[model samples]
Target: MQCTDHTVSLDTWKNIQSLGIQCKRTTYRGVRAGWRKQVKKHTNASPPGNVSLNPPSPSVNLGVINAQSVGSKSAILVDSILDHKFDLVAITETWLKPDDSTADFTPDGYTFTHIPRVSKRGGGHVTEPTHYLGRMLDLVISREGESILAHTKVKERFSDHFVLACKLNMNRPPTLKKIITTRHLKAINITDFCSDFCSSAFSTNLSEITDMSHLVDQYNKSLTDIFNMHAPAKTRTVIIRPFSPWYNDEIREAKHKRRQLEKKWRRSKLEIDRQLYSEQRHFVIGLMCNAKINFYSALINESANDQKQMFKTFDKLLHRSKDSPLPKSSSDEALANRFSDYFIKKIKTIRDLFPPTVTSTCIDVSTNICLDHFTLTTEDEVRKIIMNSPSKSCSLDPVPTWIVKEGIDIFLPALTHLINTSLQSGSVPAVLKEAHVRPLLKKSGLDQDDLKNYRPVSNLPWISKLIERVVSARISDFQERNQLQECYQSAYKKRHSVETALLRVQSDILSALNSGDICALIF
Candidate 1:
């Protein structure tokens, strides 16, 4: 017996049947396949009309196609797969080069591998009428005994080939879930919050508090209570998705409107509704593009003068969002304790490096002036300092600095008394010295899990900052009056900064140049 063009004569077919052999033919367009197999007959089998040879099981849907040159049609291909709910897919004649990345063609939920023609161009194998001309060049093959429930030929064309969809016996894995915590600060009413704060026991006896440490504890507890009462924390389960930092209210509203229009079009099945929905979709896309551009432009402009900030902006624009995850530990408390131990050990080591005792040599005093004590601060002085200070606050603050500034009249009398009592005692309150310390990464590209790569950032309470300002002002006044500060010292001095230092150096250099004197500079 001989086969020609996937066909055989009638006599040859009969001879094969008599020999207990089965033959089947599959054809699509000009493509043809002929199969020959040896059949095993069982005598105890059930009736053909009532029984089945194989039982069905849970399955995974798969698809195959020939994308001649899947350049810009990646989105279209992904959409089709999603619509058909294919769990896995294979492609032929992807026409991707070695330089082309598989990630560029792969969708979010799927991954792909590409074996391109390396030696020469257009040498890769192509498949399923995968050709403009009806031809089954692409194939979807399964292993022996592997059940395929359906083999469908999709009419939609992705390239030259038609989509071949198959359902096999496998199960798809379930998606992962993530949980996050969120605070609803927007739900709080500023007016009601202020009223509640004023009525709270925070200022029941402002001048009666003789101990500064007790006053600070009361301040922290009262503020935290008020904040929690207004905006309680909540936990929620959420799916992790790609974050768009530029997404804002306008774009969100536009997207919502577009979805409404899309639902209307789908329900009505009207051409006008479809057109309206399409317009809204385009509008939403434009809005997003504009918002992204504006957001990035503002970032660039704001960081133009700061080199470090500019590089950070560039990293965001290039999608280099590398956030190091927290290191593994037994528990959050354990991690905190580890960090505390590390920092404490480091500080102790540095302190130990200095000599325990120093030889002292007496020198003749050049000036008789001295600053023995800080003058008492009045309510007016305290109010001025608080008003001039930046509206920055930390979690440790009883209330935000801005809130204190807004109601300065209500808080000034007590705050002034607290400052005067501490000044008279010549000792800072223990509570004021306390700070909330956060571990911040030293710089980019460092090993975040290492304790040495982190630095402690201490955030002091608002009231502590106010007292510091008052003390700084008094010290500055004393230094200026006595001329105790070095004339050349340009740091931490009023009207003196890096720019002023640079100006002084430049002027000296010019003077030396004019006088024909050599000027040596060291950095």
Candidate 2:
């Protein structure tokens, strides 16, 4: 409990339990002498020292041991760790080298960072002038009473000097092992490695392949192999229905009892059993309500660190989306097919307004646009266009834009040739037309039950986008040269605007008036 101005009287303290309040009596300490939201009358700032709400611990036991050679006396070091259990241990004169393997000497759950001797460097010093007193960064923010306990001692030792060991019981790291399953293509960022590998892979593997399909297949496979070798895929856990705070033994039992009672009621033809079942159902509902109340109340009274947990719980309660199960399908493939069929139908319906007959109207061609008269796309242009494409998920080709961009320089020659071939052929590749679609919820409520409430977002490959851009540029150039489109159309044409149209109309109207001729409609 916190009181701003008034002191807590005897009655106030006694009735505190009824008010459902928790408190810590310690006064907050800050640089401004004491904690103040806004200091009205300024006072001198307090010196930075041990002026804190949390008292410093005097039981910290940190020690150091220099055993001269750790490889010979590793057993002794383990015994020392077990006996003393020191908070921190620092040892000097570790005679370890860069090429030395430490795989066998790794601790069970502890992490270690080491500094190798200075004799192995080819370049005088890579980063800093100082010696290798190796360290990590300010990754995690330390809270009150928080500390890191490092157990650096390993059984299979190799150094002459004893390894530095640190231990802390209060602030141990998390032990939960999270499994992650990913292709690792998205995670790895080795542009040089990718470029070199791709350059060699595509050149050697794709040199003799005559079939275009076979060439692309081998090229993709080689790239995939190189990537897999460098940065392998990961097997991770994906949580579908994660654990909930409100669900517990009491709630579980209550739910089970309700289910049992429901079954009994359905089975019995007598009115007495039905009446008893109704009573049980009401009792179970009350039990669930109480459990929920207790759960939220406990969360509300928790420390500030658990605010996120509380918010997640609140969100879970608000939505209750997990309770509503999806419709049953034969398999995952069946479900995908079902959704594809439904959305395709919807799309066809939407597109039916303009029939084939309407679309086949004759196009006026006063000036001939020579079908083969096209400028060959340059290497730089192709590179720029591909790079300009957004880094999105891969399509049927499974070629990510980022990966393509990373090794763009190496693959530019091949890409330029491909684009040239496409232009000369006057046909886009079938792969470019292929797309992957994902269905997303449009919005919540009012129309949630209908198929129309969902929208499909189609993701196309970078190759498709590149082709479209090329074709669009040529079309626009042709349109401008032939004056095919109306000059008054300000929407798509270059250097045209609403103001330009208005000015042209004004000029026509003034000319009509001066010539004593009627302008029926100036526009």
Candidate 3:
């Protein structure tokens, strides 16, 4: 990848500080244009210990720097590498010239990877395996759908170093399970699909079936087929670029020219070439700084009028990472067994929280069965629940909330009957019982290795949540109608909070103290 601009100064630091962003110690503003902070590994080791001894970071923040002969900016680059804590940095044109030793450029946590380009320019051809004017397809042993991409740039902007980029999926190995994609959900012909599904599946007996589970299965499969046919999922590369409105083609050309001149100066032993390179370098630096000042000034003006836009601008500067590598046991068999054990233990804990069977409940200070005045869960209630729910993706389910809500008109009777049947039979389907556990990092700046740092998020299907919502509504209605709630109870009740509870306690304490009942208050 070609770099953006190799420009940094006190003004750049002030710009970042004004935005409340902390500057990394050895700023690699030139390492890669607009350097993003590296994701440091979680380690208990204090200062003075070798960083390389620490466990490897989940990712490598690579920066390619061209020192134009290492002596000039060697210290600055070393400090930047240490401060940003880059895992792997590829440096080029160090002007090592095959005679120089590699003592000075090495930093604490890092070791250099590539061989510097040697100049035998006076003698015809270069001996580099891969050069700008060369091509070789570096293929990896990958699965059928997997891809390996190699991109080249005509100009080396950041430094004259050759960019080595390889981005893997980082997802777990592929399974035999049929994957479904819904990339084009909005374009699906829902009305037509529903019309066909109803005709083919339910035309025989219509709504006469007592058991609706079979119908629900047919409904699910039909919808799945429609999705598979219309918007099937495929393996595709997703590149997310930062929002940089000010970076234009003019600056791109200037950076490219400056890099060419730097390379030319490095290769030549002549004084005139060196002078030309120095002059061009200074001109590019001034152009870059001016461009940045104008961009930020415009950004600040626009941001003053819009808070959301300003927050977005702030988020872009931070470039927060959320990649957490999956933890695995030794073997495939071991992993499978561990997962089985975990889910088994988790289910046991969950089951322990509830009674063995569902039973009717009564209001009014009593906790006994009340079959006489039990209300039947209605079809309208289910429809209303689906309608009001927000559209979002669940963990494992292929079906989304919007799809469920959109198809409610066609699937209402089936869903309503299914829910009622589940309630009446004192059981829910096995699908609802199953859940996916995702471990999310508690903070962006925490050790990812320790299990304690992650919070397990239980993701059951949205339909399961909808069922729970319905049940919760009934329980709430019963409590509200019977007036069984306490006045001072500020929990599990709407418009009540810990703040209100604290205020009540504070008032009682103050009343006692004001009335000269300090002893009573203390007691």
Which structure among the candidates has the greatest TM-score?
A: 1
- Candidate 2 lDDT at 110 equals 28
Q: What TM-score would each prediction reach against the true structure?
A: 0.61, 0.42, 0.49
lDDT of 2: 0.51
- Give lDDT tens digits, candidate 3, residues 188-298: 677875675566555435456555466445545665676666667665554332123455677668767867875654343234444556567657656655665687677
What candidate 3 gets wrong by more than 4 Å, as runs, is 1-187, 197-206, 235-328, 331-333, 339-380, 406-408, 411-413, 424-426, 439-456, 486-488, 506-523
Clash counts per candidate, in order, are: 5, 12, 2
RMSD (Å) of each candidate, 1 decimal: 13.6, 29.4, 16.7
Considering every candidate listed, which one attains the maximal lDDT?
1
Superposed model 2: Cα runs more than 4 Å off: 1-180, 183-192, 195-201, 205-215, 239-332, 347-365, 395-399, 443-446, 486-523
Which regions of candidate 1 are displaced past 4 Å?
Answer: 1-183, 235-240, 248-285, 297-326, 361-366
Residue 452 in candidate 3, Cα distance off native in Å: 7.4
lDDT of 3: 0.53
Local accuracy of candidate 2 as per-residue lDDT tens digits, 393-462: 5645545567777778877776676566667666664666677877666654535445556677787766
Better of 2 and 3 by lDDT: 3
Residue-wise lDDT of candidate 1 within 429-463, one digit each (tens)? 77777788788777887887888988887888777
> Against the correct fold, how does model 1 do in TM-score?
0.61
